[model samples]
Target chain A: MRIRKLIPGVDANLLIKDAGKLMQDPMRRSFLRGAASLGALAFLTGCDIIDGDAAEGVLRKISELIDGAQAALVSRTKLAPTLKESDITRPFPFNAYYTEDEAPAVDPATYRLEVSGLVDNKKPWTLDELHALPEVSQITRHVCVEGWSAIGSWQGAQLSEFLKRIGADTRAKYIWFKCAEGYTNTIDMPTALHPQTQMTFKFDNKILPRAYGFPMKIRMPTKLGYKNPKYVVAMEVTNTDHGGYWENQGYNWFGGL
Target chain B: MTAETMTASQDAPIHPGWVRICHWINALAILVMIGSGWQIFNASPLFDFTFPRSIALGQWLGGAIQWHFAAMWVLVINGAVYVTLGIVTGRFRRKLLPIYPRDVVADAKAALTFKLAHDDLAHYNAVQKLLYAGVIIVAVIVVLSGLAIWKPVQFQELTALFGGYDFARYVHFAAMAAIVSFLVVHVALALIVPKSIRAMIAGR
Candidate 1:
C-alpha cells in the first residue's frame, strides 16, 4: 500500500521484533507512555489548536481578538445587569396573557384608560388626559426568547404618573395591564414602575399602527417582546401574581432581557 | 523462508505515521473545545423571562466561545491536512474504501456482538470506516453551522441552511453533542483494543 512507504513494512517477524523492542527499552516505553499521558491531558484541557490560537501567549488571552468580536462582546455584556444580577434564568419562551379577541379601536373622543385595581382613587382619563402629562422617549432593545432582537425608540407616559395619580396601595405587589383588545399581562410593581417601562404611544417617531396598538402600548425594554403588550386598555394594581399568554405557554413570565 | 513466513511478511501495518498524528491531534482539539464550549454557552443562559434552568448545567458562555472558536480553527486545518494527505497518498482507497456493504454489515454485526476481540486489525472493519466518514461529515456540519451563528448577518444563507439562527444554533449544539458521544465510543474501543493505540503511535 502507498502508506507502507511512509512507515516500515509490517511482517509477523517485524511485529514480534517491535514488541520486543518496546518491552526491552524501558526508557522509550516510558517516553511513549508520557506522550500518551500528554495526549489524554490535552483532551481534558481542550487543547489550544481547537481554540484557533496557536501562539502560546495568545492561548491564555481572555480578551476579544478582533474589533467586531470586541464590539459584540462588549455590547452584549453591557446591555443589562438584570441578566447577570437576576437569580433566575429560564430557557423557555415567554408567554404573556391576553384575551382571544382583537383590541377595540381607540375612540379618541370617549376613550379613556380606566386606572382601577388596588388604587385608592380609581378614575378614567382620556387620551389627551395621559398625553397631557410629561413624556419620555428612549431607544432600547427588545429581547425575545425566540433568540432575536430589535432596537427602537419608544415614547409614552411614565408609568410612575399613573401610579402616583391613582395613589397605588403600598401593599400592591403586581401591576395588571389590561389592553384595549382585552389582552392582560401582569408584572411585579417594581418592574412595572421601572424607569424604562412606559405606556408608549409612539414608536420610531410614528404613531404605532393598530396591530402595534395605535392609541397606546407598553414598553418594557428589560423584558421579552411578549411581556411588552400592545393596545393597553387599563391598568390594575393588584397584590396577587398573574401570568400573560406566552407565560402560560411554558415561556418564562419575567422575560427579562 | 517457508511459504507461511513469506505470507506473514506480506501483511502491511494498519496505521500510518501521518494518519496517526492527525487522529491524535484531532482528539486533543475536540477535548479542549468541549470543555471550553460548555463554559461559554452559559452566558445569559436562559430560555425566556419566567422559568429558570433549562437543563441542569453551568454558565461558561464566554469561556466556551473563546475556546470553541480557537479549537474550531485547529479542527478545520488538521482535518484539511488529513483529507489532503489521504487523497494524495491513496491511503484512503487502500484502507477506508473498497469496503463493500456486505462486508461492512458483517463486520458491524461482529463488532456489536463482541465476536471480534481486540488486536484484530485485519484492515479496519467496516464499522471503523463508517465512523471515520461520520466524524468527517459531522465535523464539516459543525464548522458551517458555527459560521452561520458566528456571523448571522454575513452568512445568511448558511444560517438558513440549518433553519434560522435560533434553529441553526440548536443544530450546532446538537452536532457538538453527537461528536462528543462518538469520541467517547472511539476512546472506549481504543482502550479495549490496546494494540490499536500502540499501532497508531508506533506506525505498526
Candidate 2:
C-alpha cells in the first residue's frame, strides 16, 4: 500500500521504511532508543537489572559507596543552615509509610525511654525526666530522602548531653533507634554527636504531634528525614549495624543531606 | 606519493580517537544519569508530570539513586578529561568558539528550513557550537546543584548560590531539561545526517 506523505516536500515512504517505525514519531523513536541505550549501559555496569535480583545486589553496594562519600563530606563543625522563626513552614508536611491517622500513639503518661547496649546506664526513664534535661530549640530544614523539605522549629534535649549523661560508649560506631511504630534506624556516632542532632520532644514549641512522631523523634538536620526516626521508644549504642526498616528495604543507611 | 603517504593524505578523520572515546563514554554516562534521575524525580515529582516508567533506569528510588551516584563519577571524571583535552588540543577554539550572533541567526534559519549542510564533518555550523558550549555550562550547573543537594551543609556556599537546599533542586532539574533538549536536537540531527553518527563512532 502507498503511504500518505506527511510533509509536503518529503515522501512518507522515504522517511520511514517500515510501518512499525512509522507509527512512532522521530522524537519518540529516539527516546526509546535512549531506553535501548539504558539496556546497553545496564549490561555494561551490571547495576540496572530491573528484572532480576542481581541488579539490586550491585546497586545496593554502590549505594553503600555513596553513603561513604556523603559521610566523608560531613563535618562535625559544619551545621545545616538554621532558619529564622519567620521561615518556618506552616503545617509542615506529614509523611510516613502509613496514613496520618495510623501514626503510632504512644501515651506520654506511659512512655518510657529505654537505653541499652554499651551504655553505663541501661535504665529506662520517663518522658517527664527527659523534659527536665537542659532544653534547646532551633528552626531548621528537614530534608527528606524522597526530595521534599520543610523548615520547622524543633525543641529537644541535645543528644550529646544525653549520651554523656548515660555514659554511652560514644566510641561505638552506631546509635540504633527503635520506634513505637516498629520503625528502626541507625546513625553514625559523629552524626549522633552533631550539635544539631537532638532527642526531639517538641515541634514548634508544642509536644510533637502524632503525625510528626509523638513522644520522641531523633532530629538530624544534616541527614535526610528518614534517617531521623520518629516515635523513638528505645536507643542502643552498638558497633553492630542492625539495619532499619527502610535501610533493609534498600534505602541508603547514611542518607546524609 | 608513496602508498603510506597516500593513505595518510586521504581525507583525514574529523574526530580524533580520544574525542570519539570520550564522546561515547560521556553519552553512556548521561543516559545512566538521566534515566536514574527521572526515577528519583518520580518519587516526589517537582512538577505535575513525571517521566514515564519505561524511560526511567533503576526500578526503585534507592536503586535509581545508586545509578545516579555511580554514573556521577564517570560523568565528572570523563567531563574533566574532555575539557582538559579540549583545551590542550585547542579543539575548543578550532571547533566551537567565536560563535558570532550573525552566523547563528543565519545557521538557525538554514536549520529550520533543513538547508544547513552537515556533509562537511570537519567544521561545525554555528548552531552546533552554541549548543555544545551551552550544554557544557549546563552540565557544570547540574553537577554543582547535585553536590549542593547531596551535602548541603558541607557545600553551603554552593547551595546558597542557588538560594539554598530546596532551591538547588529546581536548578538541577532546569539544567537537566536543558541537557535533554540538547540531546533531542543532537540525536535528531544525527538521524537527519547519519554520517555524523558514523563519524562519531568511527572517528572520521
Candidate 3:
C-alpha cells in the first residue's frame, strides 16, 4: 500500500532498481501472476450481472417497440427468437465428455434406429443395414453459449436416411432426438437434415466419447452447446414442438454463439 | 525529500528513451485490451462457479475477439522486443540490478510507501518494480490461457494447463481483472504525480 504514493519524479533511479529487484525474484513473479489471475476473475463475476441486465433491457424495449408499431415487423403470435443455423449447438471450451463405457452390448448386427413417426415403414435396420443405405460426414464448429467453441470431424449416417427408410409422414415438421441420458432436444426437420447436420458416431477421427453419446450424438454445427444433446438414445419424429432443458430455463432455444 | 527518492535519483539516469518508449507502449496495449476484453466478457456471464447470468446479447463478441487478438499481438511482440533489447544491450543488468540486501530492506519501506516520488523516470520504485514485473507475468498467463481456448485441438496440452476449456477461459478472465487493477492504480498515480505522466508523454 505504501508504494501507492510513489510519485515518479521523487526517485526515478531507485524506482528502476526496485523494479529490477522484483523482476529478479522468482517467488515474486509467481505471486504476482496468481494474484492478477484472481483479480481478473473477480472483476468478471461482477460485470456478468451488469451486462445480463443490460441485455434483458434491450430485449424488453425491442418487444415493446414492436407492440407500439402499426406495421409490426413480426406478428405478436409469431414473434420468436431468430432461428440462426449457428444456434443449434454451442461448445464449451473444456467440457469434454469423458466416459469409459464400452460400446453397447447390443449387437450392431441387429441394431438399428427405429424410425417410427408419421413414417410409412417402421423397421429397425442393423448397423450394416443402415451403412448399406448411405453415409454422412461433416466438419463443423460446436459453439457453446458459455463462450467456447471447437471444430471436429463427425462421421455417421444421415437422420433423413432413417426418416426416408420409415417413410416420414409429410406433416412431420420437427425431429426430436432422445439421448441415452434421457435428454431430449428437437430441431426443425429441414434444419435437422441440413448437409452440416449429422448423426455422428465418430468424433475427431476417433470413436465418439461414450459420454459424448458414443452410439450417436446430434451435431448441429450452427447451434449453441446445449442444443447438441449428447448420449442420444432415441429419435422421435413429431409434428408438435418442444424445447430442450436449458432452453426452458430462459436460454435461447437457438443459441448460435 | 524522502531518502527513497533521493537514493533512486542519486545514480545517473538508467532508463533511456527506447526503454521508456517500450514501457509506455506496453501499458497502452494492455489498457486497450482490458477495456475491450470486458465488453466482450459480458456475453457469457459466469461467477463464483455458480449459476450463469442468463441475459446476454452482443454481436460485439466477435469484435471483442478481434480487439483481443490484435492487442495480444502488440503486447507479445512489443514485450519480446523489450526483453530482447534489454538483454542484448545489457540494459537489463545495468538498469535493473538490485541494490544490496541491507538497502533493499531499509529502502523497501520508502519504496513501498512511494515516499520517493520526487523525480520523473527514476526507473521504478520498489513497489512499481514489483507491479511492473507482476503485470508482465500476468500477461504471459493471459497468452497461455488464450492459446488453450483459441486452438484447443492444436494446443491440447496448453488447454490442460488451466484444467480444460472452461477453466482456461476462467483463468483468462481472471488475468484480465488483475491487469486492469494494475492499470487503474497506474493511472491514478500518474494523475496524482503530473511529473511522471509528463515524462511519459514528452520523453524527458
Best by the lDDT measure = 2
Which one is best on DockQ?
2
TM-score of each: 0.47, 0.88, 0.45
lDDT of 2 by residue, B153-196 (tens): 77889999998887899999999999999998899888988888
Q: In terms of docking quality, how is candidate 2 classified? A: acceptable
Writing each residue's lDDT as its tens digit, candidate 3 over A47-136 gives 432344443344334333432331232121221122233433433122322212322333344446655566667676555665465666
Compute the lDDT of residue B125 as modeled in candidate 1: 74
Error of 2 at A217 (Å): 0.5
On TM-score, the candidate that comes out on top is: 2
DockQ of each: 0.02, 0.29, 0.04
TM-score of 2: 0.88
lDDT of 2 by residue, A12-109 (tens): 34223322332344422232223334554656543344424555566677888877876775666588889899999886877766556668989989
* Residue-by-residue lDDT tens digits, candidate 1, A144-210: 4433444466688778776887799846878888776566788766666677778888765677656
The better-scoring model by lDDT among 1 and 2 is 2
Q: On a 0 to 1 TM-score scale, where does candidate 3 land against the true structure?
A: 0.45
Error of 1 at A25 (Å): 51
